[model samples]
Target: MVDALDGRYPRNWAESWDRVGLVLGEFEHAVARVLCVVDCVPETVDQALEVGADLIVAHHPLLLKPVSSIAPDTFKGRIVHRLIRAEVALFTAHTNADVANPGVSDALAARLGLTGLRPLAPAEGAAAGGGRGAGRIGELAEPLTLAELTALAAARLPATAGGVRAAGDPGRVIRTMAVCGGAGDSFLTEAARAGVDAYLCADLRHHPAGEHLANDGPALLDAAHWATERPWLDDVAAWLRAEFPVDVVVSDLDTDPWTVHTASAHKETHP
Candidate 1:
């Protein structure tokens, strides 16, 4: 299973800082079932165990850095203990998966029905490929209002308490758009430089989003991190099924951190 994924998303393509490929489990273990998820959160771990998954091909790496201990007392250590006890293997394909031809942002662009897609921020020294980039920029088939775009995003992405939030005129017409699957606030300038009308991503901070709007850049749409990345699970599952006989499952449980939201209203003492 690891070899199959490595063939598609080569470990060499991953960023220098990224800890990818197999993170746990014995290499000799025969993987008969696989679970895919954006985050290796506890809930998803339980889901993998409950469904009798022999391997987990997660997008995010559980052990990204060297740890001093794995005594089963720490939080991440607990996850390690659980997976090891359950005899489940773990693997990651983070940035490498993002840069693949039909990668994370590509899957997102497909979900939004985008056309004429191109890289929003192409990586340096990357070989000739259609989608070797940090994010994707594309055009909508028909322009829609910012509100409409927000509605479309909410309807398409996995549901979470974070829902969706936009920073621009609600009636602003949006045609060209840019998207990054997770925590894309870093790409705001790149999206603006691409001349998109809107930039859709996850985890937009207040200062950056506000400053971008103040500078008359593209409209911003911030979604839940898990919601934005979840679409790629289907693509991964499809690829896995084509290469291996494992029964693939994509976790539907919402693992986004934010759990609730409340809209503010103007104060008026009437009662």
Candidate 2:
């Protein structure tokens, strides 16, 4: 497990300001039945309990910043306490996973069937070896209409109430594409510089997306943030299962934070 983490997410790839890698528990601890999740929330913890998971390998850190206490009064404290009581270890890859070869962005790109991929913005302080950046730019196998690509994304990613929202000319043929697993609004200019025909990611706000689309920028496909990052969970689980003699379980907690509740009248009308 250590070797896999080191190979994929080198320590140097993590930003100095970020806290990643193993957050809870020791490496030597016997971890059988691991849980893979995007975030280590209470719902995911309950799923881990249901599956009897000993460890949870997540993309985002549960405790990124230092905490003064674990008194169970605070939400984070309660999570920490719960994991400790359950003997469940927690590990996060974060930006380090983003820069890995088959990292978060690569996995997302593959889902989109993109080819000839390269980094949209290469991360700084990457080890001497070749590693891409947080986001990747690539091209589709063949040009697809913007509407078609949007359909493909919706089909590929996990279904959510948010569905898949797109901006730009629906009929515009998109060949070159860029993708980031989560919250890629900051990379708009970088994707623009890469000259991609479209950008697929999550957590794009109204103002930013509107401004970019108004400028005739790359077509945008915004997905649920959790769905975008969930692809990495499989890779993480597989790596842990292969290297360590452990059972890995992908959390099915649907912890996307957006609850879908249709009013009875609305449902009746729609039905």
Clash counts per candidate, in order, are: 0, 2
Once model 1 is optimally superposed onto the true structure by TM-score, how far is the C-alpha of residue 74 displaced, in angstroms?
0.9
- Please, what are the lDDT tens digits per residue for candidate 1 over residues 181-215? 99898899998888899999998999999999999
Between which residue pairs do clashes occur in model 2? Answer: 33-247, 34-247
Highest lDDT, which number? 1
- Cα lDDT tens digits, model 2, 31-148, are 6688889999888888888899877778888778888887899999999889888888887888888878878988888888888888888866653346567788888988899999
Q: Considering every candidate listed, which one attains the maximal TM-score?
A: 1
Candidate 1: worst-modelled 10 consecutive residues by lDDT: 122-131
What's the residue-level lDDT of 18 in candidate 2? 73
Cα-based lDDT for every prediction: 0.89, 0.83
